[model samples]
Target: MKNEYTDHAWDERDPSPWLALYLDQSTPLPDEVKAAWLRDCSSSSRQFFLPLVRPMARVSMILIQLLKIFLPKRWSHSMLLHRLLALSMNRFVSPEANWLIMRHFHLGSQVLAFVAANAPVAVTATPLTPMVIDDVKDELFLRHDLNLFNFVIRLNKALRTENKELLPVPEPDFSMLRQPDLRLEDMPRGKLNLLDLQSAIEIYTPVYQLLLTDNDFWRASNSLQLDETVAIYCAKILASPEHLVLLNNKHPLVPMTTLYAAYRLVLHGLSSEMLHSLLMRMARGEIPVPARELAKMHKAAEAVAAEESLAP
Candidate 1:
């Protein structure tokens, strides 16, 4: 969760990058920003509007084209519209848009360090760090994973507490990872472009499904774990010797949580590199978990440590 977002828009750099972290994900967002994304998801809007987004966005798309015809090149972008576009893009646009929107956050051990290490201070509007990367390091996708991430954390806790046998994790095909379908240049940047506005309204951000052939038009078929090997990377990010101990599930009791975990993995098609690595380490006895009596105390300590580092 992020600190509460106040309504103060930045005058120099656009704040959409910062806003998207909150608005699109389960993380906390500015009250008003959340309201904008609530578009039709909000309860109040349901009674009067029979889904205003698809139709309204379509109409908005037409109006945007007309505005493009008349509006001068010098003054086409509106800050308000840009803000609204960022707010709406996550729900209304393509997964490319969500992928691109996620481009805002530059991942590193620390934001400034990442910027300094990769970004040059000169010959650039802003210094590009780590060789001027557009995408943040993959570990961040772990934290920005928000509630879905919490699900992972909780599942780990449950599995370990119950002393269940480790489930077999599915092998993910990372070769499938690729760039987004939409063009980055066509997107609305710091300055507004009609295409950007239209994209915000017209495109759809898919959740689980990628190929149109994979699912129906209305239902999305993909999740973050399945989307881009996000979970696998989160596992890699946490694949330290200490983390192996922290998440170890081999306790004294033998129970059904292991079976339940397997059920979840198969049910949702979880790509389980994380679980696999843990299982290997557990089999090796490479990292010792706390004693059964002290395990509860270790769990608390592990939770706190994760709060500060792994999952925070």
Candidate 2:
């Protein structure tokens, strides 16, 4: 299992060894046990039922807009109203749904930040046009024309740079108005490496920073592994009167816990099984052993076993 752990550690750049453990077929569970475990762990049910809530969400949005007419603009945009609406929304949906929704927004913002930082010229040059969507289409039809435009512009610029080594004339399909799908057939025939796009998408420094600075985040992450020592440490931190008061006051637009889950999924491309396992552990509030402590224990046990064998 340990060998399997190291083998699959970087399979998804997942820091959690337990995730790798779950993925390793060498330690297969019985069908019934696996099914039960999956049932306990899975948030895919929220995804399954998400479409059903779209109409309700739309109605809620419309009602909120109508009510805004009676309320002052300041009141309508106030954090109080935002919190009320979020609380109401939370009542109707699972935590998974909230996580999924916020995750999308978080990822979209990350993409925009990436583009702004790496392709400033492309983002600045690209015209921001509003995308039209059919009202009858699914709620997922939400589009960001500006972001898409910037991405295409950047892609084309990269292609042009690559083209300098190849063809004299730029590909006719590469136009600002009509962005080709990022497919091999649609793209210009060249050594157009998407290293920039990859880098932009994979950047999780902000999320990492959040985890590093936050005791609650560490507590939550530790919960995934059900680590008693970390849990005790977290309890001591949380037991502080100042910390308890802060936690009571910490009402965020998006739950930091959900944000962490989403960040891990989006940034690391965590597999569905691993995600399910993580969500389950998080839900149960189990804190795992931190990797450092686990490594130390393993080394100590190995030394003790070696000494016993030498005595024999």
Q: Clashes in candidate 1: how many?
A: 16
Instruction: Note the Cα lDDT for every prediction shown.
Output: 0.31, 0.31
Best by TM-score: 2
Name the regions of candidate 1 deviating beyond 4 angstroms.
Answer: 1-52, 56-100, 104-191, 194-202, 205-211, 214-312
For candidate 1, the lDDT comes to 0.31
Worst 10 residues of 2 by lDDT: 166-175
lDDT of 2 at 298: 72
User: Candidate 1 lDDT, tens digit per residue, 120-229?
Assistant: 12111121222211222322222333423343344446546776522222221122122223333343233222222222323322211111222221111222223123
In candidate 2, which residue ranges exceed 4 Å CA deviation? 1-89, 119-146, 154-312
RMSD versus native structure for model 2: 25.2
How do all models score by TM-score?
0.22, 0.23
Q: Write the per-residue lDDT of candidate 2 for residues 2-120, one digit (tens) a residue.
A: 12323434545446545544555542232222332322234343334334443444444345445545654334122332343344323433332333333333333332332233331
Cα TM-score of candidate 1: 0.22
